[model samples]
Target: MTKQNTFLNDLRNEAITGVAYKNLMLKKQILEYFANISDATITDLSKGLNASIPKINELVVALIEDGLVKDSGKTEVGIGRRPSLYGLKSNSIFFVGVEVKKSHVNIGLSDFKKNLIKSVKRIPFQLTNSQASLDDLCIIIDDFIKSLALAENIAGIGVNLTGRINYKTGYSYSFFHFNEEPLSVIIKDKIGIRTYIENDSRAMAYGEFCSGIVDKEKNILFVNLDYGIGLGIMINGELYYGKSGFAGEFGHIQIFNNEIICHCGKKGCLETEASGSALLEAFKIRLQQGASSIITKDRPDFNDIQLEDIIQAANNDDTLAIELIAEIGEKLGRGIAALINLFNPELVILGGSLSATGDYLFLPVKSAINKYSLSLVNNDTELKMSKLGENAGIIGACLLVRERLLELK
Candidate 1:
């Protein structure tokens, strides 16, 4: 008997012994499939998963009986009896997504079918404000969940924050400043629901991969150009968190040698030149140097000018705003080109607030990539704007709960 033969025999024995386990896994798979898409017929599901129709039908029947799935009428394809469509009973289960920004928090409720139950509620609470405490944070979440009036139905809460989080351990290295206790455990104890935390970029990437416009492509980069830039790398259809879950800090990568210090304590980081914050900062610098723009043309004071105001001006083709955005895009493109060379991703997605700039951003970014990157690396790569828009983070947070928690149970 050889080692390979013994290993093969053990695998054969496990396969024979894992019938019940395999069925449970199959049921979960079917449920997840329904969760990701609108609805699917038994034939479609079987074909999609390449599994036996009888076995899938049997599990779906069990799922229907278990009140997890329901038949959603039928769809006629050609000229026959319509195949029955099934979907998850959305209201039967719920999840909460809390997206914490520096200045505000957006809380949302998602059904089992991954539909936002109501308009996302934005609470004006600052994570950086010293007046707010962990207790206050818990209360806000608890109150938000109570207001939704579906506290009992919620399986778990997912919080996506703009900081470094060891998502595996739920520890926050930036916000909350906790060392001994994971924030998830604290939130769970306070909110009376299972809680999970993730880096906002990672959560958005996961959501994009699972249900957003990315379509689960094997190799892709999701660059979130919000107040600051964050990168989400998906290699081989899985979110790459890297060692210590700090992989997506592309914003902090130093792209220039300058005296300007980033918030991350680095000088001349990509975010220092290309992020929403950096864009606004540059606009302010230009304003002080007596440069004029439609952004501050009607403003009470240049100090009151905002990033959105500049974005609006750019959308309307204000020369200064458009030029500034183009400049930022060029710098961002250089950084992205470096990433392309390293990762050789098939797709690079521009997401978050700055992505909304449309052509004002894309044209310059494309030009910079063409100039900076090797033709071989970027020729096949496609650049796209996120279809999920600002909802990416919230949707990702909601889905993360299901990805990390519900499936475990």
Candidate 2:
């Protein structure tokens, strides 16, 4: 591959002479520094990379010529000549982030500077357990790239997939089980772009870490309360993928003794009682049992009453909706309290559509956490709703592409 298309290969290990290899390594280091801090001076680069000022300055000039960086501005100073600041060019390279939701697909484009340049959300795409679904997804992605005309400049495509995924190997144990080829490999081959597939929950967690209220936090747990419940485990400031790379299946924990079957074919899993799907089921059951809701006032069949409609009704003071959501929150909090006891994460950010209910879900969760968790352990865990909201997976996918490209995450 040519140096211009560094997306398909590691930028630091290109076939080059010794002098060029050294220069490439130095440039890679400089790019890392710029990624962490948007702008840096020559002295800052030299000190950070442990290189001389002249050498660092030389590479910075080359990077500018390559269109990877630009002069942001001069560092503000009152006493002496201000050093110029170099920053990653916002349009130099791009990453495409795709989130495969059960009901829709979310695509977002992020620049080298991590700004989401454009996005197309809520495209009607159903993720079923079939090869046809995978083909449809690839076709949509191809169309998206062609429409944007970013096939050549795009660095990578990150897909946030739900279910059992070996992120290290890009092999999915669930869904799109058509071939022996890893999902990432199949996608990369089809789309002609370097591709990565990550668990939706873990992707959301990493996204929250890089872009959320995380302020140098080292340990975190991102709880995805979507159609199904899932967990993203982070320890010591790194995403922890356990043996076989399928660690964060927090929903399959058998918490209750009911006969309800989970999506994983397990009985009485946490998701059976505490997830968005569970909430929907409970809402419908209550309506069938003579409970009333604002949505039911118009349509008694309750077939169209989705999770979002219930959340909206709760927001509008629908008594039945609020009660059902609070009950789910209480159950979810019980499960989370167990997680707190186990992981003791410093921060827990709630992500997914179900978390958008705000205080309706949060209050009950907090109450349950306080009631069930050890005082010291609960005190160590700070729970908050995701700032990125439903976009966490898409944004996280974009950021992960950059992180993997730079070998920084």
Highest lDDT scorer: 2
How many residue pairs clash per model? 0, 0
With candidate 2 superimposed using the best TM-score fit, by how many Å does residue 283's alpha carbon deviate from the native?
A: 1.6
Local error of candidate 1 at 45, Å? 12
User: Tens-digit lDDT track for model 1 on 1-409?
Assistant: 3123221122223354466667766776787787665589998889887899999899888778656789988786757788898988867667888888765677788877678776454576757623255666788789888888757667788998886888889888878865467888888888878789989888888778776888647898999888899888888987898888888899998898888889989798988888999899888888889888876658859788877688888888788888999999999999999999999999998887788889899999999999999999899898888888778888889987877654621
Instruction: Note the residue pairs that clash in candidate 1.
Output: none
lDDT of each: 0.80, 0.86
lDDT of 1 at 107: 78
lDDT of 1: 0.80
Error in Å for residue 395 of model 1: 1.0
Worst 10 residues of 2 by lDDT: 5-14
- Give the distance in Å from residue 325's predicted Cα in candidate 2 to where it truly belongs: 0.6
